[model samples]
Target: MENHLYDGLIRYIIKKTRLDKGLQQRDLADLHISDGTISNVERGKVVVRDDTFNYLLNKLGLDGGKLNELVKKEKEFIEHLKFRLDCIESMLNNGYLELANEELKLIHLDEFHPLAPFLMYLKGRYIYKKKE
Candidate 1:
């Protein structure tokens, strides 16, 4: 069968639920999946089966309107992160290291932050590129 288009909406729903429940990726994986599978789902590269999705939603204590709102917020956050990354990249390329650093600091303060390490690595690379 042709693969379904990867859905950021679904991915975000899972992410928010996981974070709300304080479950790490490994912890969720141990419930009946592999860590790699969870990673793929979070990245929106794979579609999970309906039964598995329902199990996750139930486990996370999400249903009805609350679940819908979680998915909506996830999409919003994902879009915001994309925009923030773009802005950070532009600032770095324009020699605005201080601004980029400030944004990175903000991200570090978020509980479910994912890109802080990657952003730091990019900052190091930016410095190196400038020296070359």
Candidate 2:
């Protein structure tokens, strides 16, 4: 599928928020919104209104500059993550499983701050895949 810039941006923000909080997708879904809505927003297919955006930020316990900063950091962070993931995959393919595993572990340990729950979901995916 063609990637939509807004979708990518939103997804990045969602992920950042989730990671900071250290909660799983289902756990986050139980607190504020549903997993489907989170996925949809991250995909950028759905348009979020200002009220909803404010709600999300507030629910995630963001206020003032931190919230603004997160929005501003979205683009750069997403690009970096994409690049890192590509590198990790390449390493795994080139017999660098140990290195890749190390990198993955770092990601797992890194706190997403307020987005911990969402980050937990991504971590779960990474761990699940590693086990497979």
Candidate 3:
């Protein structure tokens, strides 16, 4: 993906990574970068230097290269995820298990979210319904 592809997702990924690592804002504070700056970056209010971005990722032991692509894909994934959830719920409610299962298969779970487990629940429900 191109650098322009970030489209503010860089902020989202970095911020989420920070949270997942159990590190607080102040924990990532450096001599030059403060917790407030980190907050701004995560909120998309500011863009830090490229080296700083890499350093932050390195601090969390995350690979920056692949992360960029993953974040890019996440943007698309989240959009579809929202709509798919509604469709899946409606299908399941209407006893259209097979159609719901097919729709679920089209979504890629490259990015992590609680929706993953919910999706699995839907799959199991589909199988259970088919068995009955």
List the candidates' TM-scores in order. Answer: 0.57, 0.43, 0.53
For candidate 2, the C-alpha RMSD (Å) to the true structure equals 8.3
Instruction: Give the candidates in order of TM-score, highest first.
Output: 1, 3, 2
The Cα error of candidate 2 at residue 34, in Å, is 2.1
- Give the local distance difference test score of model 3: 0.71
lDDT minimum window of 10 residues, candidate 2: 108-117
Candidates' lDDT values, in order?
0.66, 0.59, 0.71
Candidate 3, which segments miss by more than 4 Å at Cα? 1-6, 72-76, 85-132
State which candidate, 1 or 2, has the greater lDDT.
1
Over 4 Å off, model 2: 1-7, 30-32, 73-132
Tell me the number of clashing residue pairs for each predicted model.
0, 22, 0
Candidate 1 vs candidate 3: the lDDT winner is 3
Candidate 2 residue 38 Cα shift, in angstroms, is 1.4
Which of the two candidates, 2 or 3, achieves a greater TM-score against the reference? 3
Residue 27 Cα positional deviation in candidate 3, in Å, after optimal superposition: 0.6
Candidate 3 residue-wise lDDT, 22-129, digit = tens: 899999898967888677666656666766666666776767567867776887877778778878978988998878888978876524353567777777877888
The root-mean-square deviation over C-alpha atoms between each candidate and the true structure, in angstroms, is: 5.0, 8.3, 7.4
